[model samples]
Target chain A: MTLRLNLLIVLFLSFSALSFAQNNEIPAVDVKKIDGTTFNTGDIENDGKPIIINFWATWCSPCKRELNNIAEMYEEWVEETGVKLIALSIDDARNMGKVAPYVNGKGWEYEVYIDPNGDFKRALGVNNVPHTFLVDGNGKIVWQHNSYSEGDEYELFELVKKLSEGESID
Target chain B: MKNYSLLTSAASILLAFTLTFIGGELKAQQGIDDVLNNGEIRGNFQLEAQYYQEDSLIGAQDVPEKILSNGFLNLIYTNGSFSMGVRYESYLNALLGFPEGYRGNGVTYRFASFTQEKMSVTVGNFYEQFGNGLIFRTYEERGLGYDNMMDGVRVKFKPAPGLSLTGITGKQRLFFEYGEGIVRGLDAEFYLNDGISALANSKTQIILGASGISKYQPDQDSRYVLPENVGAVAGRVNITHGFFNVNAEYAWKANDPSADNGYIYRPGEALFVQASYSRKGFGLVLAAKRNDNMSFRSDRTEGQQNLLINYLPALTKQHTYNLLATLYPYAVQLNGEVAFQADLIYKFDKGSVLGGKYGMDVQFNVATANNIDTTMLNDERTTRQGYTSDWFKRGELYFQDINTQITKKFSKKVKGRFTYANLIYNQDVIEGKPGVPVIRANVGIADVTYKFNMRNSLRTEVQFLLTEQDQGDWATAIFEYSYAPHWFFAIMDQYNYGNEDPERQIHYYNASMGYNNGGNRITLSYGRQRAGIFCVGGVCRVVPASSGLYLSLTSSF
Candidate 1:
């Protein structure tokens, strides 16, 4: 009986510790926006702007399209709503050199960063790419999407517009 | 102080009582508990035992008689936004027929992991794979007794609606400890849908991704300057429209040679193309792949056993039958292979003559691989310059096969299936060394199942194989009696009857019964397990012949 009790206690403690750690881990950054520069999550939400941070890579075809599409409408989106779009590139050193060139060639106006170590990526449990998260002005993630088609972006923008206007998104 | 102590005692006692209750319930042989219970621990376990005996016909003298045992216990707990689990494995002498050094009983993984909205993290041992697993794949294979668990840290995040990122760093498993090399990787995917203002109404959809992995292993050998930092980049794009879906990827790895080629560096590249069309009851799939020296690794000196930094995708069917599967299992030779496979499935409409009382389903598949043509060497004097190996040019077809299977049902109680396949294999590259007969073979199998009632059924299968080389011709038969939700009895036999030498012949037979009660299943059988190559992916482990009793038990809690 004592042995069983001890085992149970250990199990409970272990899970409790895990739960606590999970809630406290740093929020995942938009790998496409990091650019090796240190930035805080609060910086984007400081101004009343809703922030959309996307973790992307140069070779990721879906990411490339997603970034390019967003870039085409980025300026208009900023003017319409106080929303900041940040692209974090997760390209390692092998392909990191191509990040600036690729972004420049695309003529995207949004901010870009690098997370070569994937510190921000690992913080989030992303299994597949083209995953997106929408953060409120308070820096709390409220909505997330996995894969995207052309039509899905319209729905996402609608949600972002609603969220920026203080309308219910869910 | 006295009041505080009293409260603490009460809380502890309550916790103890709760644990005891759960443990007591578990001791009664209960099913797997739901993991949603934030404070409860759930687990599953499996154990197997086998004995081996040598037969002189195939010259199986190197075999040894031994008992093999392997089992694992996993405990998982989740509370609110946090979750964690630890798995312990006791391979103890592992399995005699398996690779060496897998013979220890220890806690293989002690992990703490958690996930929230945008971030998820894991520390300790984990299993992971990247992009068709061409660059890095760490996992476990019980049947083959191969586990390359990585001990490290991993994280994944998504900061926007169309982008996702992942990063990992760790060392792969070598027996019970970590391998000598360090592996690190990054992968990201972006969806173009959100950014494409003009393509919003287009019927076509596209997703693109890129990934990179680097492996670092310190080398002490003075003779060779191995690419200490082996790296690879992979890109994939997927598009779908109407009934058509296509995914294509290209991966390239820097030059890093190995013991197979005496450390002569050769770069590697792999290209994958897959397309499928599915609607209603009809589905068609086409896949083609080309692999050239894509066997990335951390340690070039190590044999084929460890230090594999990538897994070559197999283009052949993973057969499960005894005779057809054992004769020639395909192994992806990373250095050179170009293969393609096509699969078609069509179901006959009801009320048709071929469909009879029930619809009939037909499946056909064909796959083949060949070596990449290459100049053995430009000249003996050109020491540093590597051999010229062309990426294209179907050298000699190393493997080729086609299979057709049909399943049909008559009335409600009778059903049957017929399968036929023709296969060819190159024994030299697949079986370590040459001189063994290169196999050109045809196999046919027929299976019939008859159900007398809701609870009783009988199944019979017969197989005939015709081959002129290797182990000669073969015949097989199996009969099974099953009672719904409870018991099953079966008898199986296989004979190598067409061998040239009379003494080089063998017949294997087994009778077994399996009982399933609730969450527990137990099986017992006595027979001869033939010596054959059991493979997963491109890797293979030879399962030696065994003539003995076998038992297996599995349960979850």
Candidate 2:
């Protein structure tokens, strides 16, 4: 027990010098669109509105639930806050072909793309699915989270509302 | 002296990385509003440890190291279109079921990349895949102790809007070192919709791709002359019209002999196809595939799942429920198999009879795999070609799964889902244990959630599985409660009800709690885990049987 504690403490101290400042530019990487064209993720321009990027897959049940929940209120959220949601599928070739059909069947109106090779997922250092990022008007990632439960969408909408109103979320 | 030198060099590199990251952080902290367009540093860290106990009946043994830990830190630096990254990994004695070779710690991965105009180049280590990974793929899955990254140079050129060419030459990584063979590959993809004016702006679009790979290894056998150079080639096409799409790929390999195939010089072949039609509130998909002697690896003597140059994902649904996942999981039979899968998803309109006040969603999926019919040749013992397989013939059933699920929202704050599955698993063929009777299982699950308020929720899941073979029937239940954006707790228990031996009918119980705060999470659990195959994306890893406490942490910045 003592040895494990010591290792934990040492690991903690090594990274104690800094906490993440969420004000960093998004990693620039190539992700493909539904039309089979590639574009840089950092080039996404939403006319100074906030953009919510969600990393999901066709097989993950929790990811689908979260997307469906958000999709239920996406139209209202966009109308109220002018936010744009971009759903990025990290599905490899095994299930990459199912991504489009799955999303369309869910009746989601968000812009969807495929990270067929996990390039963007790796660049962003995402460890799991249902990872979400909130970017400000200047393309700086302002907040992020992983995983989701029921009623998590309201928390995200609150943050989007704050950003749209030009107020600090933290 | 050599070991000491390697350790010192590795320590110095890690220290240097820490210093550089600290300096970058200090500069950015100096001015809150100052943006550093010159460079930026980002990274993530994960640590997992477990304590084990022995159970003779379950086959779990005592750990020499009572506590084993696995950890890694990934650091990446990016500037405009240029980027570089390194990964440091450590396994202190390694956890149970992981590769014993990874018993120490070091920097295991490094790479640098730059892109200019329509061309890009990467030097050092990189991961890549080609057209469904039928012919070539390099990747990593930490939980499975699998990493086959390439160590060399890769370049990509896109001279035109619809055409792309990629070339790579390198040696694959085997554990802590490089494989003994050299691998080279080239791939090209062209989008006909963009290249041909007639297809542009039409309802139909077409894309075509091709890949070729070769590995060169020195011949060491004195009795039989081994082929020094082996080649594999693949071609693929994708076509899409309004509300419908079709994708297919075919791959072929030269005569190659290896340990996994009893050293038979049989050429390999693989074919995969998928079609789907989807629109609002409705979707359907069908898939078919066949693989024959398609195990291509860099080293001829290697066995098990290591140093593979291609991937063959099972054309079956990746289950999520614990009982459905752990009870009778399926792994791809690489030698030869024919598989088919179909899935359907539909949602009923709100306020309708079945839709209720909210809405109802239904999904159905079925998958089956069978052995490919083949006949042994009279001269197969010493001939170059081992056997011949009939193109359209299937021998015997290998596996099958029929699953149906329904989801409905009862109210604004209440939702429920129900699922049922029936499976047929052939342990004799897939698990290589002949004479063992086939295992058939049926599973049912119900999950419900209720929201007490905007920030709090409670969820419950009940699952039951019945099987006549293997360990018998089992029942599982889970209770979870969460406070949005902060904390959650869960408790679960799985009971073996139908075991013949009453003493062995045990409850695998566990309790866990986690805290989350903006890209960071820590979870602690104590429980008994049964031995089973834990898989992600169809690739599986064995999780040994053990009873212990586990701790995990993940954070990114």
> Which of the CAPRI classes, incorrect, acceptable, medium or high, describes model 2?
acceptable
Model 2 lDDT tens row, B92-191 = 9788888777878877888777787889988889999888898898988776788888999999998987888999999998888889989899999998
Cα error, candidate 1, residue B46 (Å): 1.0
| Candidate 2 off by > 4 Å | A1-23, A35-37, B1-37, B55-58, B378-380
**Residue runs of model 1 more than 4 Å from their true location after superposition:** A1-170, B1-37, B52-66, B194-203, B378-385, B536-539
lDDT against the true structure, per candidate, is 0.66, 0.83
- Clash number for every model? 41, 0
Docking class of 1: incorrect
lDDT of 2 by residue, A27-141 (tens): 8787877645566887776898999999998878889889998998999999999999999998877787777778777778999999877788888888778889898777778
Number of clashes found in candidate 1: 41
Per-model i-RMS: 16.4, 6.0
Model 2 chain B is weakest, by summed lDDT over 10 consecutive residues, at B28-37
